[model samples]
Target: MTTDLVAAVDIGGTKVAGALVDGTGDLLHRVQGPTRARESAENVLRAVTDVVTQLTEHELWHRVVAVGIGSAGPVDARNGTVSPVNIPAWREFPLVEGVRKTTGALPINLVGDGAAIAAGEHWTGAARGRSNALCMVVSTGVGGGLIVDGRLRPGPTGNAGHIGHISVDFNGDLCPCGGRGCVERIASGTNIARYALAAGWRPAEPDGDVTAAGVAAAAAAGDPIALAAYDRSARALAAGIAATATLVEIETVVVGGGVSQAGEVLFGPLRRALGEFATLPFVRNLEVAPAQLGTDAGLVGAAAACWSDPDTFLIRGEAGN
Candidate 1:
Protein backbone atom coordinates (compact mmCIF):
# COMPACT_ATOMS: atom_id res chain seq x y z
CA MET A 1 0.00 0.00 0.00
CA THR A 2 1.68 3.17 -1.14
CA THR A 3 1.30 5.91 1.47
CA ASP A 4 -0.97 8.91 1.09
CA LEU A 5 -2.77 10.78 3.89
CA VAL A 6 -5.18 10.19 6.76
CA ALA A 7 -7.62 12.50 8.48
CA ALA A 8 -7.41 12.63 12.28
CA VAL A 9 -10.17 13.99 14.46
CA ASP A 10 -9.88 14.57 18.20
CA ILE A 11 -13.28 15.06 19.85
CA GLY A 12 -12.54 16.55 23.25
CA GLY A 13 -14.81 17.78 26.02
CA THR A 14 -14.99 21.43 24.95
CA LYS A 15 -13.95 21.17 21.31
CA VAL A 16 -13.57 18.98 18.23
CA ALA A 17 -10.11 19.27 16.66
CA GLY A 18 -9.23 17.73 13.29
CA ALA A 19 -6.05 17.55 11.26
CA LEU A 20 -4.90 16.04 8.00
CA VAL A 21 -1.71 14.12 8.74
CA ASP A 22 0.74 12.38 6.38
CA GLY A 23 2.74 9.18 6.76
CA THR A 24 5.73 10.99 8.24
CA GLY A 25 3.46 12.35 11.01
CA ASP A 26 3.36 15.81 9.46
CA LEU A 27 -0.01 17.51 9.49
CA LEU A 28 -1.12 18.92 6.13
CA HIS A 29 -4.14 20.88 7.34
CA ARG A 30 -6.00 21.51 10.58
CA VAL A 31 -9.30 22.99 11.80
CA GLN A 32 -11.51 23.03 14.86
CA GLY A 33 -15.12 23.49 16.05
CA PRO A 34 -16.90 24.09 19.32
CA THR A 35 -18.60 21.47 21.52
CA ARG A 36 -21.70 22.78 23.19
CA ALA A 37 -23.34 21.19 26.19
CA ARG A 38 -26.72 19.47 25.67
CA GLU A 39 -26.21 19.90 21.95
CA SER A 40 -27.70 16.94 20.15
CA ALA A 41 -25.29 14.41 18.69
CA GLU A 42 -26.74 15.20 15.30
CA ASN A 43 -25.70 18.82 15.63
CA VAL A 44 -22.23 17.77 16.71
CA LEU A 45 -22.10 15.56 13.67
CA ARG A 46 -23.16 18.43 11.48
CA ALA A 47 -20.42 20.65 12.85
CA VAL A 48 -17.80 17.95 12.33
CA THR A 49 -19.10 17.13 8.86
CA ASP A 50 -18.83 20.78 7.89
CA VAL A 51 -15.17 20.94 8.94
CA VAL A 52 -14.11 17.59 7.45
CA THR A 53 -16.00 18.07 4.19
CA GLN A 54 -14.57 21.55 3.91
CA LEU A 55 -11.09 20.02 4.20
CA THR A 56 -11.65 16.96 2.02
CA GLU A 57 -13.49 18.99 -0.63
CA HIS A 58 -10.41 21.14 -1.10
CA GLU A 59 -8.48 18.25 -2.78
CA LEU A 60 -5.81 18.53 -0.07
CA TRP A 61 -7.32 15.48 1.61
CA HIS A 62 -7.64 13.52 -1.68
CA ARG A 63 -5.44 10.57 -0.71
CA VAL A 64 -7.04 10.16 2.70
CA VAL A 65 -7.95 6.46 2.96
CA ALA A 66 -9.26 6.01 6.48
CA VAL A 67 -10.48 8.25 9.27
CA GLY A 68 -9.14 7.88 12.80
CA ILE A 69 -11.10 9.52 15.58
CA GLY A 70 -10.28 10.09 19.25
CA SER A 71 -13.31 10.83 21.34
CA ALA A 72 -14.09 11.42 25.02
CA GLY A 73 -14.56 8.69 27.59
CA PRO A 74 -17.11 5.85 27.73
CA VAL A 75 -16.90 5.45 23.96
CA ASP A 76 -17.83 2.11 22.37
CA ALA A 77 -15.51 1.62 19.41
CA ARG A 78 -16.98 -1.72 18.23
CA ASN A 79 -20.52 -0.35 18.24
CA GLY A 80 -19.25 3.10 17.20
CA THR A 81 -21.32 4.84 19.89
CA VAL A 82 -20.10 7.75 22.01
CA SER A 83 -21.42 8.27 25.54
CA PRO A 84 -19.24 10.96 27.05
CA VAL A 85 -20.12 12.45 30.43
CA ASN A 86 -19.07 16.01 29.52
CA ILE A 87 -21.28 15.82 26.46
CA PRO A 88 -24.66 14.47 27.51
CA ALA A 89 -26.20 14.43 24.05
CA TRP A 90 -23.66 11.81 22.99
CA ARG A 91 -25.06 9.16 25.23
CA GLU A 92 -25.10 6.00 23.11
CA PHE A 93 -24.82 8.17 19.97
CA PRO A 94 -23.49 6.79 16.70
CA LEU A 95 -20.74 9.29 15.99
CA VAL A 96 -18.66 7.20 13.62
CA GLU A 97 -21.60 6.10 11.50
CA GLY A 98 -22.86 9.65 11.34
CA VAL A 99 -19.52 10.91 10.06
CA ARG A 100 -19.18 7.95 7.71
CA LYS A 101 -22.49 8.82 6.10
CA THR A 102 -21.43 12.43 5.68
CA THR A 103 -17.84 11.79 4.49
CA GLY A 104 -18.57 9.44 1.63
CA ALA A 105 -17.20 5.85 1.67
CA LEU A 106 -14.25 5.50 4.08
CA PRO A 107 -13.25 3.22 6.92
CA ILE A 108 -13.41 4.89 10.31
CA ASN A 109 -11.42 3.50 13.26
CA LEU A 110 -12.39 5.02 16.58
CA VAL A 111 -10.92 5.02 20.08
CA GLY A 112 -10.99 7.15 23.22
CA ASP A 113 -8.88 10.32 23.36
CA GLY A 114 -6.67 8.65 25.97
CA ALA A 115 -6.00 5.68 23.71
CA ALA A 116 -5.12 8.01 20.87
CA ILE A 117 -2.45 9.65 23.02
CA ALA A 118 -1.01 6.25 23.83
CA ALA A 119 -0.87 5.34 20.14
CA GLY A 120 0.82 8.67 19.44
CA GLU A 121 3.44 8.10 22.13
CA HIS A 122 4.20 4.65 20.85
CA TRP A 123 4.31 5.87 17.29
CA THR A 124 6.44 9.00 17.72
CA GLY A 125 6.42 10.42 21.25
CA ALA A 126 8.10 9.74 24.56
CA ALA A 127 7.24 6.02 24.75
CA ARG A 128 8.49 5.32 21.23
CA GLY A 129 9.79 1.74 20.67
CA ARG A 130 8.89 0.75 24.23
CA SER A 131 6.31 -1.81 25.27
CA ASN A 132 4.11 -1.80 28.37
CA ALA A 133 3.92 1.94 29.05
CA LEU A 134 1.34 4.14 30.77
CA CYS A 135 0.19 7.21 28.83
CA MET A 136 -1.55 9.77 31.05
CA VAL A 137 -3.24 13.10 30.35
CA VAL A 138 -3.63 15.16 33.54
CA SER A 139 -5.78 17.98 32.28
CA THR A 140 -9.31 18.91 33.35
CA GLY A 141 -9.67 15.25 34.19
CA VAL A 142 -7.10 12.54 34.59
CA GLY A 143 -7.19 10.10 31.65
CA GLY A 144 -4.92 7.18 30.73
CA GLY A 145 -4.00 4.65 28.04
CA LEU A 146 -1.76 1.63 27.77
CA ILE A 147 0.49 -0.10 25.25
CA VAL A 148 0.88 -3.48 26.89
CA ASP A 149 3.04 -6.14 25.28
CA GLY A 150 2.83 -3.98 22.16
CA ARG A 151 -0.95 -4.10 21.85
CA LEU A 152 -3.78 -1.62 22.33
CA ARG A 153 -5.93 -2.75 25.29
CA PRO A 154 -9.20 -0.92 24.68
CA GLY A 155 -11.40 -2.68 27.25
CA PRO A 156 -14.24 -5.07 26.44
CA THR A 157 -16.41 -2.38 24.86
CA GLY A 158 -13.54 -0.02 23.99
CA ASN A 159 -13.75 1.94 27.28
CA ALA A 160 -10.88 0.15 29.03
CA GLY A 161 -8.65 3.09 29.84
CA HIS A 162 -10.73 5.17 32.22
CA ILE A 163 -7.83 5.37 34.65
CA GLY A 164 -8.82 8.68 36.20
CA HIS A 165 -11.48 6.94 38.22
CA ILE A 166 -8.97 4.61 39.81
CA SER A 167 -9.24 5.09 43.57
CA VAL A 168 -6.09 6.55 45.08
CA ASP A 169 -7.69 7.09 48.45
CA PHE A 170 -10.74 5.40 49.87
CA ASN A 171 -11.78 8.57 51.74
CA GLY A 172 -10.23 11.20 49.53
CA ASP A 173 -13.04 12.92 47.64
CA LEU A 174 -16.20 12.10 45.74
CA CYS A 175 -15.65 11.72 42.00
CA PRO A 176 -18.27 12.07 39.29
CA CYS A 177 -18.12 8.27 38.87
CA GLY A 178 -19.59 7.86 42.38
CA GLY A 179 -16.21 6.68 43.58
CA ARG A 180 -14.56 8.26 46.59
CA GLY A 181 -10.98 9.45 46.29
CA CYS A 182 -10.44 8.74 42.62
CA VAL A 183 -7.14 9.86 41.15
CA GLU A 184 -9.02 12.38 39.06
CA ARG A 185 -10.87 13.73 42.06
CA ILE A 186 -7.66 14.50 43.86
CA ALA A 187 -5.01 14.92 41.17
CA SER A 188 -6.66 16.30 38.05
CA GLY A 189 -6.05 19.92 37.16
CA THR A 190 -9.65 20.80 37.91
CA ASN A 191 -9.56 19.07 41.27
CA ILE A 192 -6.26 20.63 42.25
CA ALA A 193 -7.96 24.00 42.55
CA ARG A 194 -10.97 22.53 44.33
CA TYR A 195 -8.77 20.81 46.87
CA ALA A 196 -6.86 24.00 47.39
CA LEU A 197 -10.04 25.92 48.15
CA ALA A 198 -11.27 23.31 50.60
CA ALA A 199 -8.01 23.78 52.50
CA GLY A 200 -8.61 27.55 52.77
CA TRP A 201 -6.04 28.29 50.06
CA ARG A 202 -8.06 30.81 48.12
CA PRO A 203 -6.31 32.13 45.05
CA ALA A 204 -9.42 33.05 43.06
CA GLU A 205 -12.69 31.47 41.91
CA PRO A 206 -15.63 33.80 42.10
CA ASP A 207 -17.19 31.50 39.51
CA GLY A 208 -15.16 28.41 40.23
CA ASP A 209 -12.42 29.89 38.07
CA VAL A 210 -9.20 28.88 39.77
CA THR A 211 -7.75 26.53 37.13
CA ALA A 212 -4.59 24.47 37.15
CA ALA A 213 -2.91 27.27 35.25
CA GLY A 214 -3.95 29.78 37.85
CA VAL A 215 -2.68 27.54 40.59
CA ALA A 216 0.62 27.16 38.74
CA ALA A 217 0.97 30.90 38.43
CA ALA A 218 0.27 31.42 42.13
CA ALA A 219 2.76 28.71 43.09
CA ALA A 220 5.36 30.32 40.83
CA ALA A 221 4.89 33.48 42.86
CA GLY A 222 5.66 31.39 46.00
CA ASP A 223 2.16 31.16 47.36
CA PRO A 224 2.06 28.59 50.14
CA ILE A 225 -1.48 27.49 49.37
CA ALA A 226 -0.69 26.87 45.73
CA LEU A 227 2.43 24.99 46.73
CA ALA A 228 0.38 22.76 49.00
CA ALA A 229 -2.10 22.10 46.25
CA TYR A 230 0.59 20.97 43.82
CA ASP A 231 2.25 18.87 46.47
CA ARG A 232 -0.94 16.97 47.19
CA SER A 233 -1.58 16.59 43.49
CA ALA A 234 1.90 15.14 42.96
CA ARG A 235 1.44 12.72 45.82
CA ALA A 236 -1.89 11.42 44.56
CA LEU A 237 -0.72 11.22 40.95
CA ALA A 238 2.46 9.34 41.89
CA ALA A 239 0.59 6.81 43.98
CA GLY A 240 -1.64 6.03 41.04
CA ILE A 241 1.32 5.64 38.70
CA ALA A 242 3.01 3.24 41.10
CA ALA A 243 -0.04 1.03 41.38
CA THR A 244 -0.49 1.03 37.60
CA ALA A 245 3.17 0.20 37.07
CA THR A 246 2.87 -2.76 39.39
CA LEU A 247 -0.26 -3.97 37.68
CA VAL A 248 0.88 -3.48 34.04
CA GLU A 249 4.65 -3.61 34.52
CA ILE A 250 4.90 -0.53 32.34
CA GLU A 251 8.49 0.52 31.62
CA THR A 252 7.70 4.21 31.46
CA VAL A 253 4.98 6.68 32.41
CA VAL A 254 4.58 9.48 29.85
CA VAL A 255 2.63 12.38 31.41
CA GLY A 256 0.78 14.97 29.33
CA GLY A 257 -2.05 17.54 29.55
CA GLY A 258 -2.21 21.21 30.47
CA VAL A 259 -1.59 20.63 34.18
CA SER A 260 1.61 18.86 33.25
CA GLN A 261 2.76 22.29 32.13
CA ALA A 262 3.40 22.96 35.81
CA GLY A 263 6.59 21.01 35.07
CA GLU A 264 8.59 20.19 38.21
CA VAL A 265 5.80 21.27 40.51
CA LEU A 266 3.95 18.20 39.21
CA PHE A 267 6.73 15.82 38.07
CA GLY A 268 9.60 16.40 40.50
CA PRO A 269 7.55 15.48 43.51
CA LEU A 270 5.77 12.84 41.46
CA ARG A 271 9.07 11.01 40.95
CA ARG A 272 9.88 11.23 44.64
CA ALA A 273 6.49 9.91 45.60
CA LEU A 274 6.72 7.08 43.06
CA GLY A 275 10.08 6.09 44.49
CA GLU A 276 8.71 6.15 48.01
CA PHE A 277 5.62 4.10 47.20
CA ALA A 278 6.89 1.49 44.74
CA THR A 279 7.68 -1.80 46.56
CA LEU A 280 9.50 -3.52 43.73
CA PRO A 281 12.95 -2.43 42.54
CA PHE A 282 12.47 -3.25 38.84
CA VAL A 283 9.47 -0.99 38.64
CA ARG A 284 11.47 1.77 40.26
CA ASN A 285 13.27 2.62 37.05
CA LEU A 286 9.98 3.36 35.36
CA GLU A 287 11.17 6.73 34.10
CA VAL A 288 8.37 9.25 34.48
CA ALA A 289 8.70 11.88 31.73
CA PRO A 290 6.63 14.73 30.27
CA ALA A 291 4.84 14.25 26.96
CA GLN A 292 6.45 16.01 24.00
CA LEU A 293 3.59 15.98 21.48
CA GLY A 294 1.96 19.23 22.76
CA THR A 295 -1.52 20.07 21.37
CA ASP A 296 -0.94 18.08 18.15
CA ALA A 297 -0.60 14.73 19.94
CA GLY A 298 -4.30 13.97 19.68
CA LEU A 299 -4.46 14.44 15.91
CA VAL A 300 -1.12 12.75 15.24
CA GLY A 301 -1.98 9.88 17.52
CA ALA A 302 -5.40 9.57 15.91
CA ALA A 303 -3.67 9.42 12.54
CA ALA A 304 -1.14 6.99 14.01
CA ALA A 305 -4.00 4.68 14.94
CA CYS A 306 -4.63 4.12 11.21
CA TRP A 307 -1.27 2.35 11.10
CA SER A 308 -2.55 -0.34 13.45
CA ASP A 309 0.29 -2.70 12.80
CA PRO A 310 3.34 -1.47 14.68
CA ASP A 311 5.71 -3.50 12.53
CA THR A 312 4.53 -1.82 9.36
CA PHE A 313 4.64 1.70 10.79
CA LEU A 314 7.76 1.54 12.97
CA ILE A 315 9.74 -0.81 10.66
CA ARG A 316 10.63 -3.25 13.46
CA GLY A 317 8.24 -6.14 13.03
CA GLU A 318 10.62 -8.68 14.47
CA ALA A 319 11.46 -6.60 17.53
CA GLY A 320 7.87 -6.75 18.78
CA ASN A 321 4.26 -6.75 17.51
Candidate 2:
Protein backbone atom coordinates (compact mmCIF):
# COMPACT_ATOMS: atom_id res chain seq x y z
CA MET A 1 0.00 0.00 0.00
CA THR A 2 2.34 2.69 -1.17
CA THR A 3 0.91 6.19 -1.15
CA ASP A 4 1.21 8.53 -4.12
CA LEU A 5 2.82 11.88 -3.55
CA VAL A 6 3.89 15.03 -5.35
CA ALA A 7 7.20 16.77 -4.92
CA ALA A 8 6.46 20.44 -4.45
CA VAL A 9 8.81 23.39 -4.69
CA ASP A 10 8.09 26.98 -3.67
CA ILE A 11 10.62 29.44 -5.01
CA GLY A 12 10.60 32.96 -3.59
CA GLY A 13 13.07 35.81 -3.27
CA THR A 14 14.01 34.85 0.26
CA LYS A 15 14.04 31.06 0.11
CA VAL A 16 13.59 27.93 -1.95
CA ALA A 17 11.39 25.38 -0.16
CA GLY A 18 10.55 21.79 -1.09
CA ALA A 19 8.15 19.25 0.30
CA LEU A 20 6.52 15.93 -0.44
CA VAL A 21 2.77 16.28 -0.33
CA ASP A 22 0.28 13.44 -0.26
CA GLY A 23 -2.97 13.47 -2.16
CA THR A 24 -4.80 14.82 0.91
CA GLY A 25 -2.66 17.97 0.76
CA ASP A 26 -0.57 16.98 3.75
CA LEU A 27 3.12 17.80 3.76
CA LEU A 28 5.02 14.63 4.66
CA HIS A 29 8.62 15.78 4.46
CA ARG A 30 10.15 19.19 3.94
CA VAL A 31 13.43 20.85 3.10
CA GLN A 32 14.54 24.38 2.36
CA GLY A 33 17.48 26.65 1.60
CA PRO A 34 18.06 30.36 1.39
CA THR A 35 17.64 31.87 -2.06
CA ARG A 36 20.75 33.56 -3.24
CA ALA A 37 18.66 36.21 -4.95
CA ARG A 38 21.56 38.58 -5.52
CA GLU A 39 23.90 35.89 -6.77
CA SER A 40 24.38 34.57 -10.29
CA ALA A 41 21.67 32.56 -12.03
CA GLU A 42 23.51 29.33 -11.41
CA ASN A 43 23.72 30.06 -7.71
CA VAL A 44 19.99 30.49 -7.41
CA LEU A 45 19.36 27.37 -9.43
CA ARG A 46 21.73 25.50 -7.18
CA ALA A 47 19.81 26.66 -4.16
CA VAL A 48 16.56 25.27 -5.63
CA THR A 49 18.27 22.06 -6.66
CA ASP A 50 19.73 21.71 -3.21
CA VAL A 51 16.26 21.62 -1.71
CA VAL A 52 15.26 19.01 -4.26
CA THR A 53 18.30 16.99 -3.35
CA GLN A 54 17.30 17.07 0.26
CA LEU A 55 13.76 15.94 -0.58
CA THR A 56 15.12 13.06 -2.62
CA GLU A 57 17.03 11.92 0.45
CA HIS A 58 13.78 11.43 2.34
CA GLU A 59 12.67 7.84 2.81
CA LEU A 60 9.30 8.45 1.10
CA TRP A 61 10.85 9.90 -2.05
CA HIS A 62 10.14 6.62 -3.82
CA ARG A 63 6.41 7.37 -3.61
CA VAL A 64 6.64 10.66 -5.46
CA VAL A 65 4.74 10.54 -8.75
CA ALA A 66 5.10 14.12 -10.03
CA VAL A 67 6.94 17.36 -9.45
CA GLY A 68 5.36 20.80 -9.17
CA ILE A 69 7.18 24.12 -9.10
CA GLY A 70 5.55 27.35 -8.03
CA SER A 71 7.93 30.19 -8.72
CA ALA A 72 7.59 33.90 -8.26
CA GLY A 73 6.18 35.42 -11.39
CA PRO A 74 6.15 36.00 -14.13
CA VAL A 75 6.24 32.32 -15.11
CA ASP A 76 5.80 30.80 -18.55
CA ALA A 77 4.03 27.49 -17.97
CA ARG A 78 3.98 26.80 -21.67
CA ASN A 79 7.71 27.35 -22.08
CA GLY A 80 8.67 26.08 -18.59
CA THR A 81 10.58 29.26 -17.75
CA VAL A 82 10.45 31.84 -14.96
CA SER A 83 11.51 35.45 -14.49
CA PRO A 84 10.85 36.47 -10.91
CA VAL A 85 10.86 40.20 -10.23
CA ASN A 86 12.98 40.07 -7.07
CA ILE A 87 15.47 37.60 -8.49
CA PRO A 88 17.05 39.84 -11.10
CA ALA A 89 19.49 37.18 -12.23
CA TRP A 90 16.82 34.88 -13.62
CA ARG A 91 15.46 36.35 -16.81
CA GLU A 92 13.35 33.58 -18.28
CA PHE A 93 15.35 30.87 -16.55
CA PRO A 94 14.54 27.29 -17.53
CA LEU A 95 13.18 26.30 -14.12
CA VAL A 96 11.22 23.25 -15.20
CA GLU A 97 14.13 21.94 -17.20
CA GLY A 98 16.47 22.57 -14.29
CA VAL A 99 14.28 20.65 -11.83
CA ARG A 100 13.73 17.88 -14.35
CA LYS A 101 17.41 17.15 -14.29
CA THR A 102 16.91 15.83 -10.76
CA THR A 103 13.41 14.35 -10.90
CA GLY A 104 13.67 12.81 -14.39
CA ALA A 105 10.69 11.40 -16.32
CA LEU A 106 8.15 12.59 -13.76
CA PRO A 107 5.50 14.95 -15.02
CA ILE A 108 6.49 18.49 -14.05
CA ASN A 109 3.97 21.29 -13.59
CA LEU A 110 4.85 24.95 -13.45
CA VAL A 111 2.74 27.89 -12.29
CA GLY A 112 3.14 31.37 -10.91
CA ASP A 113 3.20 31.64 -7.13
CA GLY A 114 -0.15 33.44 -7.11
CA ALA A 115 -1.82 30.68 -9.12
CA ALA A 116 -0.26 28.14 -6.82
CA ILE A 117 -1.84 29.79 -3.80
CA ALA A 118 -5.21 29.83 -5.54
CA ALA A 119 -4.95 26.17 -6.37
CA GLY A 120 -4.09 25.33 -2.79
CA GLU A 121 -6.95 27.35 -1.33
CA HIS A 122 -9.40 25.99 -3.85
CA TRP A 123 -8.25 22.44 -3.30
CA THR A 124 -8.25 22.26 0.48
CA GLY A 125 -8.20 25.62 2.19
CA ALA A 126 -10.38 28.71 2.26
CA ALA A 127 -11.86 28.36 -1.21
CA ARG A 128 -12.55 24.68 -0.95
CA GLY A 129 -15.98 23.65 -2.31
CA ARG A 130 -16.37 27.00 -4.03
CA SER A 131 -16.84 26.90 -7.77
CA ASN A 132 -15.37 30.34 -8.35
CA ALA A 133 -13.07 32.39 -6.14
CA LEU A 134 -10.17 34.82 -6.04
CA CYS A 135 -7.21 34.35 -3.71
CA MET A 136 -4.71 37.09 -2.98
CA VAL A 137 -1.57 37.71 -0.96
CA VAL A 138 -1.05 41.25 0.33
CA SER A 139 2.47 41.45 1.66
CA THR A 140 5.52 43.24 0.30
CA GLY A 141 3.64 42.98 -2.97
CA VAL A 142 0.08 42.05 -3.92
CA GLY A 143 -0.51 38.96 -6.04
CA GLY A 144 -3.59 36.93 -6.91
CA GLY A 145 -4.97 33.93 -8.77
CA LEU A 146 -8.42 32.93 -9.94
CA ILE A 147 -10.68 29.90 -9.88
CA VAL A 148 -13.34 29.97 -12.56
CA ASP A 149 -16.05 27.37 -12.94
CA GLY A 150 -14.37 25.12 -10.38
CA ARG A 151 -10.99 25.12 -12.06
CA LEU A 152 -7.72 26.93 -11.59
CA ARG A 153 -7.11 29.42 -14.37
CA PRO A 154 -3.43 30.22 -14.56
CA GLY A 155 -3.78 31.50 -18.12
CA PRO A 156 -1.30 30.70 -20.85
CA THR A 157 1.56 32.56 -19.22
CA GLY A 158 0.57 31.53 -15.68
CA ASN A 159 0.01 35.17 -14.75
CA ALA A 160 -3.75 35.53 -14.92
CA GLY A 161 -5.70 37.04 -12.05
CA HIS A 162 -2.90 39.44 -11.31
CA ILE A 163 -5.27 41.78 -9.52
CA GLY A 164 -2.43 43.70 -7.98
CA HIS A 165 -1.40 45.36 -11.20
CA ILE A 166 -4.93 46.28 -12.16
CA SER A 167 -5.41 50.04 -12.00
CA VAL A 168 -7.84 50.88 -9.24
CA ASP A 169 -6.91 54.56 -9.30
CA PHE A 170 -6.22 56.09 -12.67
CA ASN A 171 -4.84 59.22 -11.02
CA GLY A 172 -2.76 57.43 -8.37
CA ASP A 173 0.99 56.97 -8.23
CA LEU A 174 3.05 55.04 -10.73
CA CYS A 175 3.89 51.45 -9.84
CA PRO A 176 7.20 49.69 -10.18
CA CYS A 177 5.54 47.27 -12.60
CA GLY A 178 5.40 50.19 -15.06
CA GLY A 179 1.70 50.55 -14.49
CA ARG A 180 0.05 53.70 -13.21
CA GLY A 181 -2.32 53.44 -10.25
CA CYS A 182 -2.02 49.70 -9.76
CA VAL A 183 -3.73 48.17 -6.71
CA GLU A 184 -0.40 46.95 -5.35
CA ARG A 185 1.01 50.45 -5.51
CA ILE A 186 -1.63 51.58 -3.03
CA ALA A 187 -2.58 48.43 -1.08
CA SER A 188 0.59 46.45 -0.52
CA GLY A 189 2.20 46.36 2.94
CA THR A 190 5.02 48.58 1.77
CA ASN A 191 2.67 51.12 0.26
CA ILE A 192 0.48 51.13 3.39
CA ALA A 193 3.47 52.04 5.52
CA ARG A 194 4.71 54.57 2.99
CA TYR A 195 1.34 56.27 2.85
CA ALA A 196 1.15 56.48 6.61
CA LEU A 197 4.65 57.94 6.91
CA ALA A 198 3.97 60.47 4.20
CA ALA A 199 0.88 61.60 6.11
CA GLY A 200 2.88 62.34 9.29
CA TRP A 201 2.11 59.08 11.07
CA ARG A 202 4.79 58.07 13.54
CA PRO A 203 5.26 55.08 15.79
CA ALA A 204 4.69 55.60 19.51
CA GLU A 205 8.10 54.10 20.12
CA PRO A 206 11.08 56.45 20.14
CA ASP A 207 12.93 53.98 17.90
CA GLY A 208 10.47 54.78 15.08
CA ASP A 209 8.96 51.49 14.01
CA VAL A 210 7.35 52.33 10.69
CA THR A 211 5.98 49.21 9.07
CA ALA A 212 2.55 48.07 7.99
CA ALA A 213 2.21 46.24 11.30
CA GLY A 214 3.18 49.40 13.11
CA VAL A 215 0.60 51.34 11.18
CA ALA A 216 -1.99 48.68 11.93
CA ALA A 217 -1.29 49.15 15.62
CA ALA A 218 -1.67 52.89 15.28
CA ALA A 219 -4.91 52.42 13.35
CA ALA A 220 -6.16 50.20 16.12
CA ALA A 221 -5.35 52.96 18.58
CA GLY A 222 -7.28 55.51 16.51
CA ASP A 223 -4.36 57.39 14.98
CA PRO A 224 -5.97 59.51 12.29
CA ILE A 225 -3.01 59.25 9.90
CA ALA A 226 -2.71 55.48 10.31
CA LEU A 227 -6.44 54.97 9.97
CA ALA A 228 -6.44 57.09 6.80
CA ALA A 229 -3.62 55.02 5.28
CA TYR A 230 -5.44 51.77 5.87
CA ASP A 231 -8.65 53.31 4.61
CA ARG A 232 -6.94 54.29 1.37
CA SER A 233 -5.48 50.82 0.99
CA ALA A 234 -8.84 49.27 1.74
CA ARG A 235 -10.53 51.46 -0.83
CA ALA A 236 -8.02 50.47 -3.47
CA LEU A 237 -8.41 46.80 -2.61
CA ALA A 238 -12.17 47.08 -2.60
CA ALA A 239 -12.13 48.68 -6.03
CA GLY A 240 -9.91 45.95 -7.39
CA ILE A 241 -11.92 43.15 -5.79
CA ALA A 242 -15.16 44.70 -6.94
CA ALA A 243 -13.86 45.01 -10.46
CA THR A 244 -12.83 41.36 -10.41
CA ALA A 245 -16.19 40.22 -9.10
CA THR A 246 -18.06 42.32 -11.62
CA LEU A 247 -16.02 40.87 -14.44
CA VAL A 248 -15.80 37.22 -13.40
CA GLU A 249 -18.67 36.70 -10.94
CA ILE A 250 -16.53 35.29 -8.20
CA GLU A 251 -18.40 34.37 -5.03
CA THR A 252 -15.49 34.67 -2.65
CA VAL A 253 -12.12 36.34 -2.25
CA VAL A 254 -9.65 34.67 0.12
CA VAL A 255 -7.01 37.11 1.31
CA GLY A 256 -3.75 36.12 3.02
CA GLY A 257 -0.15 37.30 3.61
CA GLY A 258 1.48 39.70 6.04
CA VAL A 259 -0.85 42.65 5.59
CA SER A 260 -4.00 40.59 5.89
CA GLN A 261 -2.90 39.57 9.39
CA ALA A 262 -3.89 43.08 10.48
CA GLY A 263 -7.32 41.45 11.13
CA GLU A 264 -10.07 44.03 11.70
CA VAL A 265 -7.76 46.89 11.03
CA LEU A 266 -7.72 45.88 7.38
CA PHE A 267 -10.87 43.81 6.98
CA GLY A 268 -13.28 46.16 8.75
CA PRO A 269 -12.47 49.03 6.43
CA LEU A 270 -12.21 46.69 3.47
CA ARG A 271 -15.78 45.48 4.01
CA ARG A 272 -17.01 49.01 4.33
CA ALA A 273 -15.24 50.16 1.18
CA LEU A 274 -16.43 47.10 -0.68
CA GLY A 275 -19.99 48.22 -0.03
CA GLU A 276 -19.24 51.46 -1.84
CA PHE A 277 -17.63 49.83 -4.89
CA ALA A 278 -19.39 46.49 -5.38
CA THR A 279 -22.81 47.95 -5.80
CA LEU A 280 -23.92 45.95 -8.81
CA PRO A 281 -26.65 43.46 -8.00
CA PHE A 282 -24.75 40.56 -9.49
CA VAL A 283 -21.67 41.27 -7.38
CA ARG A 284 -23.26 42.60 -4.22
CA ASN A 285 -23.18 39.20 -2.53
CA LEU A 286 -19.46 38.73 -2.86
CA GLU A 287 -17.76 37.43 0.26
CA VAL A 288 -14.21 38.07 1.45
CA ALA A 289 -12.52 35.86 4.02
CA PRO A 290 -9.10 35.28 5.51
CA ALA A 291 -7.07 32.48 4.01
CA GLN A 292 -6.30 29.34 5.93
CA LEU A 293 -3.13 27.18 5.62
CA GLY A 294 -0.97 30.18 6.38
CA THR A 295 2.55 29.84 4.93
CA ASP A 296 2.08 26.27 3.68
CA ALA A 297 -0.32 27.30 0.92
CA GLY A 298 2.51 27.68 -1.55
CA LEU A 299 3.76 24.14 -1.12
CA VAL A 300 0.32 22.59 -0.92
CA GLY A 301 -0.90 24.54 -3.92
CA ALA A 302 2.12 23.53 -5.97
CA ALA A 303 1.20 19.92 -5.32
CA ALA A 304 -2.42 20.60 -6.19
CA ALA A 305 -1.31 21.89 -9.59
CA CYS A 306 0.33 18.55 -10.29
CA TRP A 307 -2.91 16.69 -9.64
CA SER A 308 -4.85 19.06 -11.90
CA ASP A 309 -5.49 18.25 -15.52
CA PRO A 310 -2.86 19.96 -17.62
CA ASP A 311 -5.39 20.89 -20.27
CA THR A 312 -8.41 21.82 -18.17
CA PHE A 313 -6.55 22.86 -15.00
CA LEU A 314 -9.12 21.03 -12.90
CA ILE A 315 -8.57 18.62 -10.09
CA ARG A 316 -8.60 15.15 -11.66
CA GLY A 317 -8.71 12.79 -8.71
CA GLU A 318 -9.79 12.36 -5.12
CA ALA A 319 -7.85 14.03 -2.33
CA GLY A 320 -4.58 12.23 -1.54
CA ASN A 321 -5.25 9.55 -4.10
Give each model's whole-structure lDDT. 0.80, 0.89
Write candidate 1's Cα lDDT for 246-294 as tens digits. Answer: 8878888999999999998888778888888776977888888899898
Q: Cα miss at 201, model 1 (Å)?
A: 2.8
Q: What are the per-residue Cα lDDT tens digits for candidate 2 across 25-60? A: 999998888999999999999999999999988999
Model 2 Cα shift for residue 139 (angstroms) = 0.9
Q: Candidate 1: TM-score?
A: 0.90
lDDT for position 167 in model 2: 100
How far is 74's C-alpha from truth in model 2 (Å)?
1.3
RMSD after CA superposition, every candidate? 4.3, 3.1
Candidate 1, lDDT over the whole model: 0.80
Number of the predicted model whose TM-score against the real structure is largest? 2
